[model samples]
Target: MIRSAYSLQAAEAEIPALSATPLDVVALLAQAHHPEAGAVVLFSGEVRNHNQGQDVDYLEYEAHEAMAEKMIAEIINDAHAKWPLKIAVAQHRTGKVAIGETAVIVITSSAHRHEAYEANQYIIHRIKHEATIWKCEYFTDGSKKWGGNCSCCPPAL
Candidate 1:
């Protein structure tokens, strides 16, 4: 369901379920389009080839679907309260994500670039820290470890 502070005709927001299918960045950007919006910000989190010097094979993501959606909606609402946004949308991928694949995407549109940029950054950061999602990383050497803290790598022992 779309969640937005403005009326349906004025804004758009969404939190889609995690899918094995690749995310369509174009479609997400399209959703944030508005005639009055002059600035649009898009953020994509992709699976990289290496992590802490390990040749990563792939990454697995899991989420509490229902709660995650709710948390994302709250984030959208908070963004609206903080900025004058035309629209905002965020989505996260679940299941195995191969190297170079898009894992998460966030789009925000506003009348000014500063608002769009700041709101976009805030939304992505909050989602990483507040959402109930877990990630497990697999390495090429047959070693694996679960990641902690969405903002950075797991703390060293």
Candidate 2:
């Protein structure tokens, strides 16, 4: 069942390891192109230098590769089931990502702007909550901490 779904020509998903190079948004956009689709939404999650009032130097991302890929594929498949999407592609980076570098990319195409936008949002949100990707923040003050998500970090006390 998974093999058949993965064989589709329009869908693309990847979990690039530490040795792999950085993500290319243009390339990912190109991969999501579908002739019938009128709208394409692209999203990139980048690493930043500050978090919760702390000075962050960088972030290291680690994923259970096989499970991560499987979860991502499932998420994309779920998106297709929910909307009339032409194609969807998402890629996440593993290992150390410097400040200003992209950590993840998501592209979704559909016949209209609304579907494309909603699907894109849904994909990204689901990936954040569902994927087994762990993050460790390296602070400039020589401290490191783990387990807080980029979007929902706890407020400084």
Candidate 3:
């Protein structure tokens, strides 16, 4: 098996866990700042007003909290294995989220722009596709769909 390019253990993150409260993007970004890191990247996954042909009113998320957090931490570790990072963090919200609200955020910092960008992308993608989190969309049309598992962004207007 191929090992990490940098063998340093990933620092235990206080982020990368499920949140019942709003995700604090600014605070997480601040925490990701590091003197050694020349580039910091952040991806915010927000709740949108629509999806597919439905006019969405709001969203509700649920998760097996412990399992989701453990998976996210492992994703962060995988990102560390691929890139030499100064900081890496991710968090997702559970319960109700209104339109224009942020549901998830991932932050990464590295010595170069490329590493930070790629690692941040990797973390968010893995979290969306692999985490135990689930989303339910409530449409203004009075219908609801129970699975859009990813915290997807609003499509262009």
Q: Give each model a TM-score.
A: 0.86, 0.84, 0.86
Expressed as tens digits, the lDDT of each residue in 54-94 for candidate 2 is: 99999998889889888888888898899998778788888
Model 3 ranges off by over 4 Å: 1-12, 149-157
Query: Can you give the lDDT of residue 80 in candidate 3?
Result: 85
Evaluate residue 10 in candidate 2 and report its C-alpha lDDT on the 0 to 100 scale: 27
Candidate 3 residue-wise lDDT, 1-157, digit = tens: 1133222123335454888988878877777777678999999999989898789999999999999989998988888888998778888999999999899998888999999998988888778778898899999988999986544643311
Instruction: Report RMSD (Å) for each prediction in the order shown.
Output: 4.7, 5.3, 6.1
Report lDDT (CA) for all predictions: 0.80, 0.79, 0.82
True lDDT of residue 48, candidate 3? 83
* Residues 1-157, model 1: lDDT tens digits: 2333355434353336355578988877767777678999999999998887779999999889889888988888889899998888888888899999999898888988999999988888888877887889999999988974344633321
Candidate 3 versus the native: TM-score?
Answer: 0.86
Q: Whose lDDT is higher: candidate 1's or candidate 3's?
A: 3
Error of 3 at 109 (Å): 0.3
Q: lDDT for model 1, on a 0 to 1 scale?
A: 0.80
The collision pairs in model 1 are none
Model 1 spans with C-alpha error above 4 angstroms: 1-17, 149-157
